[model samples]
Target chain A: MAAEVVASTVEIAAASQVGMKALGAGLAVGLTGIGAGVAEMGIGSAAVGATAENKDLFGLVLILTVIPETIVIFGLVVALVLWFV
Target chain B: MLAPEKMSRLLIVASKDQLAPITGALYRSRLFHIEDFVVEGREGYDGFSIGKPLAGASEASGGLIKVRSLENVFAIRPDDIDPAGARKRHDDLARVVDRELAKIGTEVEGLTSRRSKLEASIKEYEQRIHEITPFADIPVDLSLYRGYERFAVIAGFVTKNVAIREPAESRIVKGKSSNFIVAVVPNEDRADVESELAGAGFVASPIPAESGMPHALIDDYQAKITQAKAEIASIEMNLDAIRQKHADFLVACEEVLKSEVEQAEAPLRFATTDQTFVAEGWVPSSRIAGITDEIMKASGNRAYVAELPIGPHDVVPVEYNNPSFAKPSQFFMNIYARPKYTEIDPTLMLSIIFPIFFGLILGDIGYGLILLALCFALRKYFRGEDAEYFLKVIRNASISSIFFGVLNSEFLGFAMPWWPPYSFSRHLISEHGGHGPMIPELLLLAIWIGILHITLGRVLGMVNHYRQDHGEHRMKAVLANAGWLFVMWGVLVIIWSGIVMPLMPDLTGFPMLVAIPGLPMDIPGINVTMVLGGIMILAGVIFIARDSILEVVELPSIISHVLSYARLVAVGLSSVAIAMVVNFISIGMLIEPQLENFTLIGAVVILAGVVVFILGHALNTALGILGGGLHSIRLNYVEFFTKFYKGGGLKYNPFGLKRRFTED
Candidate 1:
């Protein structure tokens, strides 16, 4: 009876481990997405204002606006690593 | 080659009489970048003032305007036509062009005015025909409707049908949108008739003054319109013939006049006195000798040319002297900010690295080929000043994508035929139809890239500081750059031994984490790499603080910048996922099910599936371009460039014209 109880407990622990891993991956992506959005809000508004003034600044403005988006990439990698790697 | 082309300041002092030949020489050589003299300035100019335009500046400018107007009407651009054979002398060309201009002007202007008048008359006739058509069904003539004595006539279309009381005879013609109505009543009961009609929501349509059958009038107007149109066509034909006959002449005249205007106006930028003229400008250092010799020969030894010493912070107009292939990459540097005169130009490095990053992120054979075709197709459309530069950069990037795509074994997010079925870890794609579990390894690879890229920037920073800085400050600037490098490598070593080895080790044969024997090896829990890493970090921190204590606060930025390269892998994987999802939805969810139960409706469904497939991939491709291009360059600008670059260079715009049609 003792041996059967120990094996059953091991099976329960394994199931919970998967659930925890999924939760961790979800958090990683969600929080990073929020962080990236916060970073971009300030830059996006400033870029639009600058572009409005000088039409030729369109190329430079585009690069500035997308810089924060790379932060989300970091989050995505972390999430993928948690789930798959 | 790594820096901007060397610029030497050129100052010229010539007798007032020699201005013509010297100006001509400068204009023809196209080597001078003039610094305009400020006429109103109260500086140390002494008696010198801005020189008057050489001689025929006003006359040349007026001729230019006339030639350009003719050129514009004829739609002739400098680049559109080649220089005609046997160039004419200026006086002859001007006389000929002016005579032709007068003849063409009178003929073309008269024809145009006549055509416009005919068009206006046609519009009026057409309007009359439309107004009369509404009254077509009414048999009453125009005279009978208008000349009513001792009777009131209300004629218009009405919305709702209304009954009229006694004294008015109502004639109604019903039509599609509204009904045409005419009421004739005694003059005494006119108000009553008007009130009744107004209650039914009446609208008025004026009858034409001419008395004729509606059909007859329409036929007459139509004949007139047809004649007018024929005349207009003849006018167009005449104009086109004129354009064809004199197109080459107009182009030649315009080129000569433009050059004349440029050369005549050259003295506006020169400082002058009553007796002599002085000009100052920058020329390429190597070309200065050649230009001086030419100017001396042209002026018959009357002009004196001297090279002035450039100050430390003097404004130097930078012209890049990159190799032919690397020329296109200067577009990116120009966009961000051109490098300073004394600074190291990172354009070549950007040219080589940015494409690799783009390819790595958008690595798929299908996307690569599509982009290649797109770049080729778009090459013709973007003919602005920098179109070739943009197209070449994109083409290089597309080729890189193909190379990286083959290594990734991904053909539009699906496993390629060469993708190893047994060895799942070898390729970036999985046989099971999704991204592989090698994402961590890719991320690590990106980190390594970051490390090397940042290291190069830091080293360049050292070189820039050594070159630009004066004395003691130079040593400090270089040491500060060295400190950053130390911190970057030390952090990488620490992470490699402490984190990468223990947590993510996919490749067994990869080179890293080789523990060498050292004094710190005896420590129970610590290794030599970690000990060395700690010492380096400490030394780096001290060196950095020595330059500016506040700079130590930015130390973590180096570590974060390294982590920023993780985006290279993360972004690519996201693109792959999108492509795969699109493929799965269109082929599996849409097409495959319809094929299983093929029917008449199934054909439509399959068509929809194909459209969905194409549209979805199109969306993915656009995103791939934006993500791959912007993010890849952003890494260079924000991470790599910040370490070294301080760009505020002006472009070298020489005073003379780069003649496309006429040569001096």
Candidate 2:
């Protein structure tokens, strides 16, 4: 009975470890997306404001808004790194 | 630093006597007043000075003349000769000249009328020639071949022949064809004609008819039209010069006659009235004393002067001032200042808060340094009115970024040496778990910021209300806003503590309250306390709703306003989540031992990773800035302003001299 209990405990510890690794990976990916979204929120608003002020700024606004998307790309890299590691 | 000062006094004056001198001085100084008054009774003076001499003259001779108004005498002194005469003598001479010119003018009018008739006749003949030219000639070339012989036939005839068929009758030939012989040939059914032609056994191949007169007539008409058109063009070119000379002569005669009439009547009596000569103008404050002295000298000490405070009208005129006169910095301030009179100056507020917010969101020392460098560089490059505004914004943002970077314990992505050299050092340090300093702390800070911002907005709203004649309403807004803030803070604090820990226990058998199994959970005591705290918040919300609804007796409307602050959490959460993602991506990529040593591969990976990270964060920063800024403004304008602002005041504008283009 003692042996069985010890084996079960070991199995549970290993499972928890695997779960943590998975959770970390998930967090990395999820955080990246969130970051990207947050960055875009500000950029998008600014772009729209600029475009509203001057119709000629359509291209410039678009470029500026995309600049914030880098956050998401970074997030993606982290997610990939975590998965590979 | 010296306190800034503004221009204080301005005066502008317009008068008939000083018009010439003042205009000349203004032109030389490149300063003038914009006059917008409509002349109410100009017709009374139409004939009064109809022939008056050009102002600023000494004598009259030949083309020189004199004009006398009721108040002043003027003579046109031509460069070539002196115009010398008493006002009355000049006036008599002018009358005689006018009488002679009038007689000559009549004759000229008759000549002009005759010339017009001649021009019309010439045009008609030109048009007739053009019409006759195209169809003038019909020529025929025929080749006839018998079995053993060949002959060529050529003929020319007029296509359009104009003839006097009778003594008074004329016929214009419409069509003449070179193929007339062929057309006149009879068919076989005309047996007599066919038999007569066949009797000779001569199979006749008749050549077409031709004419020469139509061609000649067309050419003749074309030449005539061209000549006429040339003559008309030359005459039209000279017409303007002729008219100008005539006009000048008439004006000279009229001026002479008017001078004579003025002398004959009252010897140019100067009309006097006690009109004080009130005028207003704008001058650089530095030059105010000089301008006042000059004005007094010119007015003969008959003007009153005073200074007015710099109001909206004093600073920026409403009419006749170019829109571009507003400096970019002033314009930016005006964006938040002038639109709603009751609102706080957003320029001042933005100058304070935007940098702090940016630093909080971005929070990396290395990144902050980069931003500072970039901002400074951009400031140097873009140095103008607009650039000044940008520089101010960037200067503030860079300071905030640096401050946040220190607080967040990040230099680049690397942990500072003072802290544990690990990404989760703070979390690890607090693992003994009593009140942890970690992600949760960061989130709490964001919430605290929101609370402060909302509170400030409410305070501003109340102030605005009080200023706009709603003292009672302002008091209510203040109370309601305070009540909610206190309730939210109190509840949040209770939930943060573990007072109710004993009510529920976790799987570890520890005392807990309100713990949920199989889900991420905080301590039970904190959870239960949060529930209680939530009730307090709810109560405060109800009270705020009641106050707003009661003021307008519209209960439903208050719900929308209360819910609006929810965006505060939404935006904050978005920023935090984005940061976490960036950190994750930066750490996620595997660095194999063998590949790590390969400089090229490592460099490539690092470059790609850095690029992605920077781009992602930049995007997030931009988005957060814009979203937070706009929503922040929206909250102020709608939820807050609705509580107080009354913004329909007309902007005051004053007329002032402005140059559209500058030569120097």
Candidate 3:
């Protein structure tokens, strides 16, 4: 009887684990996106101001603004692995 | 493919009479880069002084100023007049310019003064009318109020009529809207009465210094003000008519006068010796025949053109000769600095590499197509020289990205049904582990790319150093580069044998068993690869600088530079990952749910998902375009150019006119 009870409890634990994985995936994408937004705020404004003065800097400023996007991308990869894989 | 055009200096000698036509010819050819004649350097030459402007320059300049004033007054633009008509008018203008200007000047001054006089009188009468209108109800002559010797009249508009003490008679005169009070108080009681009037907000009005009734004077002032206004309007109408009549002629006159001044002053840049003039300039080798022919024809064979040898001290200006396909890359190179005339132009190399780097970073078919569409749409609206070049680079990057994206089998981060077995990304993911995250494999690929890129840089550096000279120093530089290459290959092999072999023992045999004898491969922590790499690095340090041991520090920098390419894989992986997440939320969560349930709530969810889908992809595509484009150029500018390029050469700017208003 004790062995049967243990086996049933393992199945429930597995179900909860799957639910936790989904939560973790959501947090990874959401929180990292916020972080990317915060980092981009300063860079994006500075880039715009620079590009306004000299249009030649448009390409350069764009690179600077999207540089922080790598962080969110990392979060996205993690989320995909958790949910999709 | 890689070299700039060759340049040769020229010395042109011509008689003083021929200097004007010769300089004009040079300007017309648009092939000369003139070197200014300094007065201090004329000591060796006989009686050489700086050339003065031609005799006609002063007159032309004076006419230019007048023409500019007329243009401003008439608001005339060159584009508004027909070119042929303007040319004819300009040719005939010299005879009539002075006369027409004097007549127009006098007429404008007369009109201006008349208008000002009318405006001044109108303002004066309007003020008088306002003052008299308040007291129009008094029904008495203005002289009566001012000549009252015993009675003190306090009259102005008031909020209300106030109560006054006895012996002071108060009368309320109706104003335009408010009531005006006339209080005749004795001199002694005036102070007390004025205080009571102040309480009612009374502003005392000064009687007009005239002899007519208040209402009659007000009507007379109003009539005169109206007449003055009508006259001013008529004067303005006449001015406008004059402006319209002269607008086309004024613009034509300005263009003609400006060109005349430019031509007349051309002799100032030449060296003169009372009888003959001398000028020095550089012209491209190919254009020498054309320039010489033009100058000879223009000067009637009076001017001599001879090519002088380039000197060691002379700093020659550089102009690239890249093909049209590689011309756009010159924009990024120009931002750094023009390459020296003697050095290889890196534009062709950059054009090939930059797009490849961008394509590798943004390897998504959907995103690439979106970027390509964006470029096509944006290129139409943008104008100017720089804008066109910027758009061209973006278009090239988009094309390259699309090509690589197809190889990756990624459409908005979702794997396509048809995957090519030969694609690098597909093969990588499949060989490593087709499930879960493939970050480690991506990092490995990025490092391998970094190794290849940096090695190519070192090889270019080797060629550049060897090209400078063939001597002891050249050999030293060549050996130093070779040693660096050896060290790079050695370190990579060490990492493979030492770290990779232990992790994946089945792929390769143990390094100790396969080690070749006489090499330093037997150390415990270090294998044959590590020992060989160390020996090469030490040898490189010695070759680069035999005396200074500090050169060894640079060995680590080479490693770091290679590792920097890891960002390529990191960026591409992140982009793909984000695209997958977008697809999951929009399609999997929203669309799939609606397809399954077909409920009202499901439809609303799908609507929200569509918004998320559009907005999210747009943002990603924009960031990808920006990041991929810039980073690709940056790698060339920062990583690749540092290996071989040394910029700071002056650009070749030929002395010529880029005229838009008039043709030569």
Candidate 4:
């Protein structure tokens, strides 16, 4: 009976720990995604206008459009670290 | 591989009459990139006005315009005529071009005019039919509606039937979607009746001056419309036949005339006088001898070719001088900018490094083999397109992925059949007979890669500064490059020795260099690595501040940029995670449980699992490619190129026509 009580308490602590890590991971990705979106908004519009003027700018514009996405990838790495490590 | 091809400025001077032969020789040599001769209005250039085109430039230009117009009329494109197709020989091209152009132009004009006439008649018949269509329901003579002096007829479709409180006769026909009403009122009540009808949303259409029964007239007009359409189709067929018969001759004519016009107008770019002419251009040093010989032979020793000394400040055109294997990466370099002649071309380095980064991210046996197959398949369809170069880069990357996949022991997202040697899987542990949750090790690996890549960039920056700057400035510039490296490494060492090692003992820190492989060198023992870190940071800050004070603000970027390479591990992990999740859902949860039953529902479950597996893996594959390719290129362009490369060199364009459908 004593051993069962200890095991139950340990399980509760583990559950809360996992839950907190999950929350932290969620915030990391969500906030960074928002940041990346804000960054891309201005660049994406300007890239479109430039591409309209010169179609050859399409490749450069595409690269520029995706550069901010790297920030989101960084966030993902952080989230993985929080969850796994 | 690093430097652009060397060029020498060449000057050609000749008597006015030898200009044509010299120009012709230059065109045929195809090695000279002409520098336009500006009229400076001083000294030797005072009498040297822009050269006029030789004899037949105008005539050739006019013929070219006609041929181009004929091409437009027939909608003929370069793709329509195969370059290798055996063309009919025209012994006298000028006569043949003129004769064919005249005959085809007249024929097309005649056919087009007839078609337009038919189309116009068809429109007229349609308009007459539209006016009579609404009136057809009313049994009235159309001439009686128009030629009345004392009576006015108001006839149109309406929303609802109006109570015409006038000495009037009215008929209402209700259609499916709307109501059609026609009314005729006395002249006195015409205004009143019209207002009442207008209140019901009545719109009046004018009657046509045709004296005939309604539906019969409509059928006659419809028949005429059908016949006119057939005539237009026949005319279009005749035009297509003409296109098929004359496509080769016409395209060839356009090519020959285009070449002639360009040759004739070439002199406009040269400086000339009544007695003499001068032309200046750059020729690749390797081809200078052959070109000079050709020019001399063509001019029959009449023109003088002089090799001019090229100054440091001259804008020499740059052609990349990479090995054949590295040539395809020029696709990326050109999208950014071609390197200047004075700077190193980064194509060779990019070709070597980019695929390795790609492999590190997309390393999976199943996906790698699939991508390799996909690249070859795409190459077949995209032949002769710019995309072919990009596809070649992806193919190389796929091979690298296969190599890394073997090392990682990943097949799809599952562990290899035997115990895998290495793993970066997020939750799997070796004790559980699974691969890994080796996050710390992979993160450390990413950091080391970042350090190596960034350091190489700084070292290249030093070399560039050494080549580009002058005297004292060169020293300072090169020192600044070194300073960035020193600061970055110093901060890294401090973090490792003072903070990280004491906290987590699992990460075996990067090895510091000692004297020899077998020798363990002793150091001044009070945490020597940390002390060295402090000293290096101090020295680096001083050196960087010597160049520009604000550059110190950018020092943090060295660390942040290093951390960014963590995406290599992160993106790959995400791809692996997706594949694992898909397999678990489709196979473990859906198919495996039902496989024992062997019932109809079991069969359905297996089919659904297969669909989910295919779709999910396909999605992951697409994501893998996009993430791997973009992140690798981003590191090169944003992080690496920022160190040493600044590309604004002029492209090497020689004055010669690239023909598509003409013979020499």
Which candidate's DockQ is highest?
Answer: 4
DockQ, candidate no. 4: 0.61
Residue-wise C-alpha lDDT for candidate 3, range B1-664, written one tens digit per residue: 7878889899999899997788778876777988778778554566787888877889889878877765665566665544444244445676676777778767877887899899999889988888777668777777766666677877777887678888998778665656787778888899899888888888888766777898888888888988999999999899899877776556656666776677677677777898999998889999998999999999898888999999766878888888898888888777766788777788888888888889889977788888888778987687655677777877788788888888787777767766442355532234234544445565566667767777787787787778764667787777777777777776666566555432222212345534454534332354555666667766666765652356566777677566556557656766766677787789887788788868888889889999989888887887787668766776666556776777677789887754444454
Candidate order by lDDT, highest to lowest?
4, 1, 3, 2
Higher-ranked by DockQ: 1 or 3 = 1
lDDT minimum window of 10 residues, candidate 1 chain A? A55-64
Model 4 C-alpha lDDT per residue in residues A14-52, reported as the tens digit of each score: 999999999999999899999999999999999999989
Q: Which 10-residue window in model 4 chain B sums to the lowest lDDT?
A: B501-510
Ranking according to DockQ, highest score first: 4, 1, 3, 2
lDDT of 1 by residue, B1-664 (tens): 7889999999999999999999988887888999888777646678998888878888778877877876776677766565667665656775576677667777777877898898899899889888888767777666677777898777898899888877688888888988888788889998888887888888876767878777777788889999999998898898889888877767777767777888888888899999999999999999998999989999998898999999776789889989887899998888888888888988888889999999988888899999999999997677654788989999999999988888877777777777453222323446666545476567777888888899999999999999988888899989999998888777766555454343333232234345444535232244567667778888899889888899999997887888889888888888888888888888989899999989999999899999989998999999999989988999999888888998878889887776554445
Summarize candidate 1's per-residue lDDT along A44-84 as a digit string, tens digits. Answer: 99989998998657657766787777668767777888877
What candidate 3 gets wrong by more than 4 Å, as runs, is A1-85, B41-47, B58-260, B420-422, B426-438, B462-487, B501-525, B546-554, B598-604, B659-662
Error of 4 at B285 (Å): 1.1
Chain B vs. true chain B: TM-score for each candidate? 0.84, 0.43, 0.71, 0.90
Question: A81, model 1: CA deviation in Å?
Answer: 1.1
Please, what are the lDDT tens digits per residue for candidate 4 over residues B306-397? 89998777899999898988888998898878898889899999999999999899888889999999998997667454587889899999
Alpha-carbon shift of residue B476 in model 3 (angstroms): 5.5
Candidate 2: stretches off by over 4 Å: A1-85, B1-300, B305-346, B380-384, B420-437, B470-592, B595-664
